[model samples]
Target: MTQIIRSLDEIAPNYDVLFCDLWGCLHNGVAAFPAAVAALQDFRAQGGRVVLLTNAPRPQQYVAAQLDRMGVPRDAWDAIVSSGDAAQDAMFAGAVGRRVWAIAQPKDEGFFTDIPEEWRDAPPITRVPLDEAEGIVCCGLFDDLTEVPEDYRGRLMLARERGLTLLCANPDVVVDMGEKRLYCAGALAELYEDLGGTSLYFGKPHPPIYDLARRRLGLDDNARILAIGDGIATDIAGAAGEGLDALFITGGLAFDQFGPDVENPDPARLAEWLALRAQDPAYSIGRLR
Candidate 1:
């Protein structure tokens, strides 16, 4: 059974490190959550280290810039890790091929900056049509706010016909952008997979990102790291995969399934829902506060 807590203060002292999620747990797409930021500040004041782990397709510096723009305090976290970093590292290590088709908005080109010039093959990192590419790297949709997974059926089908391997930079299906939900790269990846295409996910619920997080924190395998996030499929499942405890925040993207009141979701129903998804979060809260 999951403990429905009112605040993270109740369990803050139990962990040495906090593997915090950035998008949904700390903020919506537009602004920072004051309470969540304050909670991390207080946790760090007590000597605990907080690391912001995000599935953002860009590197940590890009995410830091966005967080600073949104007024998420610098002192709220000690370090940052992103799925883009993992993907870039994989590309550099020769895990992914060089002739690539990037499927993302123009603003998302930062995700490929780390691919060394010497390592790339001839005609590297093209934004051309999928038919002309050897592999695919999907950071996100060209327009997340206006598009859904259905909007990419034709493109995904074409990619499937070519048998291109896709590398999904972000594993989140959807995220809350203020009050509205925006489709993410994971939704498109899922659609591609359903159409018999192979996809390599780079973020949460995958081993590579967690491995990077653990190394960034300089922690051993047995460290008491607590992962806090709103997504059960990504955050909670990721923590469980890495043998860490997780705290599920209900006020983020999963608010609809929780109940009418986002702040006070029915615990019984939430538990049943988690059970249905085969997720077992050690603790749950309406919000990070």
Candidate 2:
């Protein structure tokens, strides 16, 4: 049974840190949620560390820059841990091999160029044509706004024939960008796996990203950490997998399932929805605030 709470302050004191999601919880991909930002600020004012644990397929620095553009103030979070950072580590270490085919947008070039300080001495990774590649690196769709997973079926089929392992940067199937829903790298990976291709995931709902977040926190294993997000399969599932408390924001991906009102969720409807998904978050809120 999960409890429906009004605000984060109700449970803020119980947690030493928060591993918050970016896309849907803190913002709608266009602007920062004023209440969400304020809640995190208040949490930090009380000495709790807030780490924006996002599944964005780019390094923390790039994500941070995007947050800056979205008006997510610096005081709201202590750090950021992204899927790209984790996948980049595996990539440079030859997890996807040295020569690979990249499925990403022009904005995602930083995934290769911006090497973290510690990884500067790592082996070089080069991007080549699909026919000459040993693996596939899927940062995201070349154009998320206009593309769907099915659009890449032909290319993925070719990669599968070659037995290329796809390294998925973000394991989110879909994310709401303001009023529009966009396909992410995970959607392509899911399609690839359906096509009998091997896909490696490093984001939420997987241990790699959580491990990176824990490393960033630098806290004892027993430290109280709350994971906040709206993605049922990615955020809530990841929190459950990590044995951490989760705060589910109903207004993101599954906003309509909780009844007519977006802010005020119908308890029974919320319960039934969660039950259907087999997810038992510690707390549920209409929004992150």
By lDDT, who's the top model here? 2
Estimate, for each residue in 122-168, the C-alpha lDDT of model 2 and write its tens digit.
77889999999999999989989999999999999999998899999
Candidate 1 Cα outliers beyond 4 Å, as residue runs: 114-126
Candidate 1: residue pairs that collide: none
User: Candidate 2: where are CA atoms >4 Å away?
Assistant: none
Give the clash count for each candidate: 0, 0
Q: So what's the TM-score on candidate 1? A: 0.94
Q: Evaluated with TM-score, which candidate comes out highest?
A: 2
What's each prediction's TM-score? Answer: 0.94, 0.98
Of candidate 2, the 10-residue stretch with the lowest lDDT total is 115-124
lDDT of 1 by residue, 44-129 (tens): 99999999999998888889999999999899999999988887766555454666778788777777665545556534454556
